[model samples]
Each structure stands twice: as structure tokens, then as C-alpha cells.
Target: MSKRSDQITLVAGGAGFIGSHLCRALLDRGETVLCLDNLQTARPSNLRLLERDERFEFIEADIVNPLPLDVLERTWSIGRVYNLACAASPPQYQANPEHTMLTNVVGTDHLLRLAERADARFLLTSTSEVYGDPEAHPQHEDYRGWVNCTGPRACYDEGKRAAEAMAFDFARMERTDVRVARIFNTYGPQMHPDDGRVVSNLICQALSGNDITIYGDGTQTRSFCYVSDMVEGLIALMESEQVQAEPINLGNPNEISVNELLTHILALTGSDADVVHRSLPVDDPRRRRPDISRAQRLLGWQPRVSLEEGLAATCAWFAGEIDGGRVPRPTAPDRVRASVA
Candidate 1:
């Protein structure tokens, strides 16, 4: 392996929504990035922009299994590892519950071992789902979640919980340098229109002139962090001089109800789509907002994008995809892969 310090970064699931953006950010900083993904839930179009970059290399592989160590050793000396691998959306994740669990537990273990061997700085991009149907409002990192291990969402919720456990264990027992970011609801360009996430669903339904489906009474709330802001926070947390063994929340604190978010989407698209209410999925969190005090105190980072601006930019990207006929209409069963690690 080339022993060039701080030159190579390994981003597992680097072709997915937020991962793709992180890949771009790393390349922008003049680092050689080895992006690993199975293209399971990640769209190939997301990597189109980085394909031509001489410093970017995409490896088609799954992290649930051991990585190709010989190839990794010959390719570059990895200095940083970002474990962003896992299917994030509820529908996408629940579709393959067992695989999702393996991706989080087994996949995380594989990467943690690699980080240990390489002596690289490791950052695990955990999700807000770890705080399942959170009992606490504006969840702080210290709050143990109110999760249903037997419920439909348990696969993802518990999977992430287990991943965090493994990451911290590695840090304490194996002396691995580790960071964890409990990412909340994030939306932006490059999001899969068919992923069934609320932000993408609202934008795509409105743009397609379909009835906007609100899963509950539309009273459920979520705080959304823009993709760029999220990527920035991840980088900041990973590069911080201070050790962060405990997970830190990385998300926008601006909370808005589902109805209000739909209203904004409707107004932005100028679509006269009818509103439709549906049954809420079991175990869905009624409200989710991050208490980012720890992130601010630790990394000196806070989200700068407003919901309005981020939504506008996201809408424009979907509009282009629709007009260009490049958006793939992924079927429900077909969407069943562990998207990112």
C-alpha cells in the first residue's frame, strides 16, 4: 500500500445520496477517494459527475462481506473511512429487513476492522432512526431511544443502534479512532425520486401532478438538514482534533410539520395536486428534531441552509430529471436493497 499520508479516503456507500455528495466534497479537497458501493439502492446517475475525475475510483462491492483487502492494499493507503452504508428510507429498508440488519451490524464490523488495520480515522454516518419513535423531543445524543425491536421499522432502527454499539466497542477495545454522526432527515439534489422518503415523495408527487399523500394527519414533524450542510458537518466531525467517541447529532433544528412541508412543496412547484391522507406506518416517529448543542460545542458546526432554499434547489433537480426522462421508476420490491453501508 502507498503510505502517502492524508491522501486517500475510503467512503463506503459513497455512490448514494449523501455519500455521493461527500465523495464530491472529498475530491474537491484534492484527496483521492475510493468509493465502494453495490449500486443496490444507489442510482448510477448519482456517480456520473465523479466518474471522470482522475482521483475518484468506484469499487462495486458490498460491505456485508469482507472487503477486497489485497486490492485496497495495492490501490492506495487509506487514511480516512466514512461508513455511510445502509438503506435509509423506511420503505427501502423495511423491504429487506434481514439484509438491512446485516449491512448495519456486519458491514460496520468489516469497516471497523479495516479502519483498525489501516489506523485511519473512522466516521460512522448513523441515522436519527436510532432514536426510534423518540419519546424525547429535539432528541439529544444522550437519550436512549424508545424502539420497538419487533416492529416493522426495527430492522433499520435496531440495525443502526447495533452499528453504533459496534463502533464504540471498536474504539474502546481495539483503540480505533472513531466518530459517529447521528444524521437526521436530510433532503437535496441527487435524492432518488422513488426512494419513498417524505421529502422526495412530496416533491415528486407534486411535480407529477399526483395527489400528495400525507401518511398520518400530517401532524408528524421532522427537521431537515440540507445535503451540503450535512456533508460539511460530517467532514467537520471527522477532522476534528478533539476525540468524539460518542455520537453527535448533525441536522437542521428548524422543525416543521408534514403539512407545512407539503404546503411549501406545493407552492414551490405551483402544482394544484390534491391532498390525500393515509394511514401512518407502524412505529413511525410522530416528531423528530435534533438537539444539535453537542455538535455546535464540539465541532463548531451548524446548518446554514433554510428549508425554503433547500427545497427550491431539490425541486429544480427533480424537475430536470422528469423533463429529461432520466428518473427511474423503481418498483417497491425492486427497491429492497441495503442502499448504503
Candidate 2:
């Protein structure tokens, strides 16, 4: 292990799906981790698994406000910071657009300053949504996205775009070492039961004999990367010395249409659910896929988990959640709390 591996790391959204997994991976590498989350879209149950680990610490706070740097400094010495704090799903993010915008901008700025104070490497988990309704297929790093700044999804899409701009500005002017990952759609275990993402929605609805709703004619396509694979790509990008101050696409290249994904989930769950169509939301991307050539060349990373294999694992986890009555219904927002293990 390198000497830097012993340094403390901070994860802004450590209690969320991807953030929790990254925290565990960092802990496994013998690094002390400080996880900060407000639990707005995430639940405390996600951090339950790491509660017993002495090296892991959880702080309940929102990133939209300035981070508790004083408390953090008293706790441990910061070395690397991973800013994954934001409402990812459309339904959740759209619920409070103002908060979402502030989190991506103000929250990101705070973390960048913290990174500068510690002289640590900073990584921003930007999203493919930055490339709104991409005019170019298989989006590469160089393609400037065609995004609507005033659309319903702009709070997140444009917010992330601004976050990327802020990160690069800090990198160029302040010379703060930074990494930006333009992550594509991802799914796996620990996803919120009511995350409102297509994968979770279809799987949960199929498992419970509900109609599989397909928005936008079920023809729109997305490339889904497994959570574990996505985490590996993030870590690789952060650790690589060759990649710096640039955005890299990290996702599986295999594109699947909404209808095709629904069929696969139905087969996997053995459900005879009916398929229902609905109007597509405003500014929804027609085709979503990532061009991971940069990730492959720079970080030696590409998704290794096949969709079929990854979906099966995800469905199994959702099944356990449903059978145990842990799945939250759409109408009730209070039931989204995490179940402590």
C-alpha cells in the first residue's frame, strides 16, 4: 500500500447508494473515512453496515450549507475528498429543485475549498445528464452537451454542468488536483426501493405484480453500469496519475431500450406484469450511452459486470427488501428510512 493510503478521506454523500459502497471500499484499503450526508434522499440504514467499523465516522449534515470543517479537522486529517452529494433520481431531485441546485453548486464549492485547505485530491461525481438529450450518440468527453437551462430537469442537468465548470476553474486557477467522472446510469444492490429510476421501478413493480410503466414509448435507450463496476471506475480515476482536470465517461457501453430492459426484468422475476406507456417527462434524453474510451485508455477501466448478471443481483436484493416488507411505496415519503442491520 502507498503511504497516502493511510490518510483520512471524506465522502460527501457517503450514506447514499454509490457513496456507501465507495466508503466500504476505502475502508477495506485501510483508509480512515469520514462520511457526511443530510439523509434527505438517503437513509441512515445505508450507513448501518459500517457503524461498527472504528475507522468509519458518519456526520448527518447537508452539503448545501458549508461543511463542518472545524468538526472534521478535530476528528481527522483530510487527504482525499469525494463529492457525491446530490439527489440523483428525477422524482427526488424535482421534488425540491432549489435544494438540488444549491447542493450541486454551493455544496460542491464548499468541498472544493476543503480540498484546497487539505491540499488533497478532489473528485466530482458528475453525471451523464450533463449531456442533455445528447445530439451526439455514445457521448465522448469532448462533446459539449445540448441542455435546456430552464427545463424541469435543468435544476440537476445544468447544476451538474455548473459543478463541472466550478471544479475545472478551481483546478486551473488554484491548481487543486481534481478529477471529474461523467457517470452514466448505474444499478445494483442498496438502491432505494422507491428511487424512481427505471431499473428499480421496473424491478419492484414486476416483483409485486404491478404494471411496468414505460415512459416515452419504451424505445428510449440507456446504458446501465453495475454499482460495483462504477465504484471501481471512480477509484481508478481518482488514483491514476495520468488523469487530471478532465471529465471522463465511466459506464457500460451496452445500450438497452426501455422495452428491452422491461422484458429482461420480467423474465428474471418471473412476473407476468402488464406493460404500460406514459408521456415522457420534459427534457428526458432520447438515447443515453457513454463513450468510455477515455476511461479505458486513461484509468484502464471499463465496466466488467454484464447487464444480465448485474440485473439478476439487483433483482435479488430488491426481492429480499420486498419480502421483508422493507420496500417503500410511492405515495408515502416517510417510509424511505433505512433499516438498520
Candidate 3:
């Protein structure tokens, strides 16, 4: 598996949640991987294992600017490109809205041009957030979305939608082989501990035995897709010759409310965590899920891992990382003692 067949894959943001997993898969399938990452939100721990592999090389580069022409000019064959490089988490993306938009818009433009020049098959990891707060229960790929361009979450929502548009344009005008996968909520190991995502925040809070913060009335629903299932869908979409030059939805069909997810995590962790309600952030989606009928029909894909199983695995990974000193253990909140004068 370590020895690859000169099929160089430039994985933008390979040292990332889904991207890292994809890189591992490529390595297993005996394809050489060149991970192009700036390590902004990515953890080096994710790529630590792959560092020793001769076929795997990590290039600390940003796609907002042009790719290193020197590296591209050097004698190394690149046949595939997976553009997984974008600020996904709301807090991270919102921290710098302009950068997030540019990363999606300019970054895609740059990578698509690279794909065209290299004659490589391009795969874009788009987001289901493109649907915004869905009017429907489960969103289909064709849903145009009801988005607020001036909202706080617009950076991610509109950015991804724009990325999809760019991909289609490149596919048509430039005649580049392009593939798009509309990813839904995915969680697994190596996610930023404080990624400000609901799943991670809830899990960590429960593990620390703190109150679980639920935004809104906790009735808003979301579908959780295990990272492995999603990566498989991406691979299928890329490798399939029958489907091309279009967008495909990749996610789980089972939807659960925020309250339900918190209860489940608390039960799994055996933590005495209480539920706390908070004001919902502006433009926060009330409901989000993917229909995935197209994925099943065309790509023959559906999420295989159950939520329970995936969560257990994720919890165990976090536990091990914390215990082994790889990841910091979460600390309980401070308590105040009553003082009498």
C-alpha cells in the first residue's frame, strides 16, 4: 500500500478531516499523494502517520495564490486533483468572511486552472450548506437554496454555492473533467477539538461533564454523515465514468434534532451533563439534511455507518488522544465559593 504507481494526487487540504481520510484511502489503493496544505485549520497529527511514507509528500502551500510553478514544473506526474481546501466550520469561516469567500472563489479558480493544465480529473468538495436553511426536510442537489447574502453564515453558504457554480463553468467552458460532491454534516476523529461545530462541542462538553449548549429551541434538525461514508462517496463520484460534469449529494438520510443528538452523546459518554439553551446565531439553518437519491441512483452510494457506531468510534479516538497526551483534556468550568464578611 505504501508504494504508489506514479499516479500523483494533489489533495488540497489533505491534512484535514475528510481530506486526511481520503489521502489515507489513496495511499491504501497504492496511489501517490501530494498533500498541499497551509495547515491553517489542519492538524499535523493527522498527517503524522503518513509522513514516513515515500509516496506521501506534504507541501505547505496556500491556494489563494498561484501554486508553486517550480513544483509543478519539476518532474512529477499529477493525474488527479481533490479540492478540499476551504474554511468549513462556521466560527472559522465567520472569523474572516472575506478570506473564506476568496478561498472558495479564488482557490477553486486556481485549482480548476491547474486541473485543466495538468489534464487531471478534478473533484470539488462542495457543501450542503449551499441549501441554506432548507424549506424542505431533506434537501436535493437541485435545490437552488434560500440564502441571505448579507448574513453572517453567508461566507460559507454562498461561498460553497459559488464554488459549485465555478466548477460547472470550468467543466463547460474549459472542457475540464470536473466532479462535485455536496457534503453534509460529517464528524469523526481529527476534527478540531474546538471546531465550534455542534457535534464536537456537545461531545466535549459531555465528556467534561459540562452543560450542553443547544442553540434555539433545540428543535432544528440535522443529518450526521460519518466521515468514512462521505469519503467513499467522493471516491465513487470521482472514479465513476458514467457520471460526470455535474453535482452529486453525499450524506446520510437519517435526521436528528439538536436535543436528540445531545441526549445521545450524553448517554454514550455516561456524563451527567445538563442541557442549556442559547440564542441561535444569525442565519443559522433551522433544518439541514440531504436527500441523496441521486447519489444512490447514479453513484450507488449511501451512508453505511450508523450514528451510534460512528459516535462511539469518535469518542474513543478523542479519549485515546487525550489520555496519551496527543490532545489536551477538557477541563471543567470554574466554581465560586460563597464568602461571608
Among the numbered candidates, top lDDT falls to: 1
Worst 10 residues of 1 by lDDT: 329-338
Candidate 2, 328: how far from true, in Å? 3.6
Off by over 4 Å in 3: 1-4, 74-76, 329-341
Each candidate's root-mean-square deviation in Å?
A: 2.7, 3.1, 5.7
For each candidate in turn, the TM-score is: 0.94, 0.94, 0.93
lDDT (Cα, tens digit) per residue for candidate 1, span 178-285? 899999999999998878889988888888877778888999999999999999999999888875589999999999999999989999999998987878989989
Over 227-286, each residue of candidate 3 has an lDDT whose tens digit, in order, gives 999889998888887786778989888999998898788888898878878888888899
For model 2, residues 54-86, the per-residue Cα lDDT tens digits are 999998888887677644564336778899999
Clashes of each: 4, 0, 0
lDDT of each: 0.87, 0.86, 0.82
Ranking by lDDT: 1, 2, 3
lDDT of 1 at 131: 91
